[model samples]
Target: MRPSSALVLAFAASTLAQDQIPLVDKVKGWFAQATAAVTSAVPAAASSPVASGRAKVAETIQHPLTLENWKETLTVDPSASTPTTQEWLVYITGGNATCFGFCGNATKAWNASLPFLAAKPNAPKFAVIDCDAEPLLCNSWSVGPPSLYYFQIPKPLADQSAPAATVRYQPLNRTSTTVDTFKKLVLDNDFEKVEPYEGYFHPFNGELQQYGLALPLAYVMWGFSKMPSWLPMILISFMSRTFM
Candidate 1:
């Protein structure tokens, strides 16, 4: 008797599954906390700034951002962007709930900084949500930095360079003086150009987007909600087969 092809196929599939792990589940779990982590960061960032009026716009744009106002001030044209009311917020933060008090550093900085950038006259196509005390997330999108997730309306952000082009990964942090790294992501296309938002969640809305997100978040949320069902299933199936 000869071994059946089905048996060999089954054996190969079994091996493949054993060789890998279910990634969709992993992806879901991997960043499950990401949304919560970002949400938690919001209050901390907003607490001080909303209390202070200088979150956006320097007391004087005539000068560059000074050390005194670095944490709570920025210098950009207020007329740069049009004003619109939004509820949902996406945040590009360092890490999780604990990241804010511990691993987090730029959380507060972003909160204070974003408002000003968003309020700018013709302020690009996106609004700056906040800078964080933890600067890691918005600096690079590799390790240690928070994961950048896209949501409803992808905000228009430039790259971390001068004369920024529209990007979907990393959005520009006007407060970051890195220079040459100005990011520009499109509001419609998702991650069509660059790497994950600077480093953290939606740098524009500030998170993976949630039920409450409006403007950028709302837009980002729409995108996520619209994710092709077949794709996720296919991805899940392939991952299941590969990683089992």
Candidate 2:
């Protein structure tokens, strides 16, 4: 073959090879590009206005319900001549570090309903409890995390020594529908189907249960107090030596 013709044939072979790439390889290349684009988009989407707005709502609207503030947050003063009519809506959930399953979606729905509930007149007070933070308070109430409880405290709040009437929101799924129902329940103050809180008030059965729980620890401490101070030090030294 002529040298010039040989060069032209080689060039044509290269061009044909390029065009003859396998279909599966081309598809894989396209898929990789698409996946990269989606991955890059996710962080931006996560930090979008919707997410920021939810964060803002959580900060501004929901009050952290702790053991210290639970009574002040939930109960009302009956002695006041001009008693204010107020009730409570509590969202109980596990800690962020330990949360799983429906906790994320349930929390999102709870946060989303706050703005609507807060806008209404005579809106029920909103509080949230992190079960991981207030395990004792949650346990006394026999409440599991990621649950909603609506409390309707009756008058003579002090005399009504029983656990307040409450209704729990139990939804089959976590969605906007749950949010709407939560808001509606608060605004309407509709507790036609209320149930006595199975959990005891701290002043009542709860206090006794708390003491019962602490009895073992108290006994241990008492035993320690009776022991010679040198005993603990010797035990500690022995344990350290054993471990070593």
Candidate 3:
């Protein structure tokens, strides 16, 4: 074969080997990548938005629910003759802290939505329960603060002794944590029925997209450069026989 043809064949063989021949190298690369991924993931998992948001919410709320009025505020009497179809639109706030001593995002959303939400044919009662002040009450239900829970009473009745059964409004990873979303949650009366909002790009894909094609092509070129000259000839010959 001509020098140019031989070089071309050799390059082609090297490219094939770079992808398949170095088994040990491939394994080591995989293991290293997996280890790095796990190591890098630890901190991110620990400090997720939900985790940090809850902490921040806790810090903001200075005045929480007190034991004195807790029972009276959350009570629902279903056994009475004129029993009302009661539902509690409770905001399990981190604290009494609003963004500017008024109301936070969730609170503001509720404030704007209140007119519409209350106008519903059979609207539920609305109240905010400070998790910071009522940790025991909040913890009993395994709730993370700065969340919303809907309570259907009357039928459930007020069992001051035990915690109320509530439906958590856990929208798609906090996407549906808005007042409009909560209003929908209340109107639908089922959190599960609500579809997760996909308005934003997926976080995993966003990170990958930021990398682009340069990094992958660079790795492929690096692998090709590291290939042994003879390795390509062997691969090419093997391919020729396998095909013929």
Point out where model 2 deviates above 4 Å: 1-46, 77-84, 95-101, 154-177, 188-191, 198-244
lDDT of 3: 0.49
- Best TM-score among the predictions, by candidate number: 2
Worst-scoring 10-residue span by lDDT in model 1:
177-186
Ranking of candidates on lDDT, top first: 2, 3, 1
TM-score on alpha carbons, each prediction: 0.24, 0.54, 0.40
Q: Model 3, which residues run further than 4 Å from truth?
A: 1-65, 77-84, 95-103, 155-176, 192-244
Superposition TM-score, candidate 3 onto the true structure: 0.40
lDDT over C-alpha atoms for residue 85 of model 1: 23
Q: What TM-score number comes out for model 1?
A: 0.24
Count clashing residue pairs per candidate: 69, 0, 2
Can you write out model 2's per-residue Cα lDDT over 1-244, one digit (the tens) per residue?
A: 8664554454444344334435664465556556766777566444678867976987877789876687676765546433244567788886432232336667777777788888887767778888767765665455556677776665454454444344444332332446766655666654445454444333223444556653343333334434553555565556557655
| lDDT for position 19 in model 2 | 40
Estimate, for each residue in 25-48, the C-alpha lDDT of model 1 and write its tens digit. 336444756666677756654455
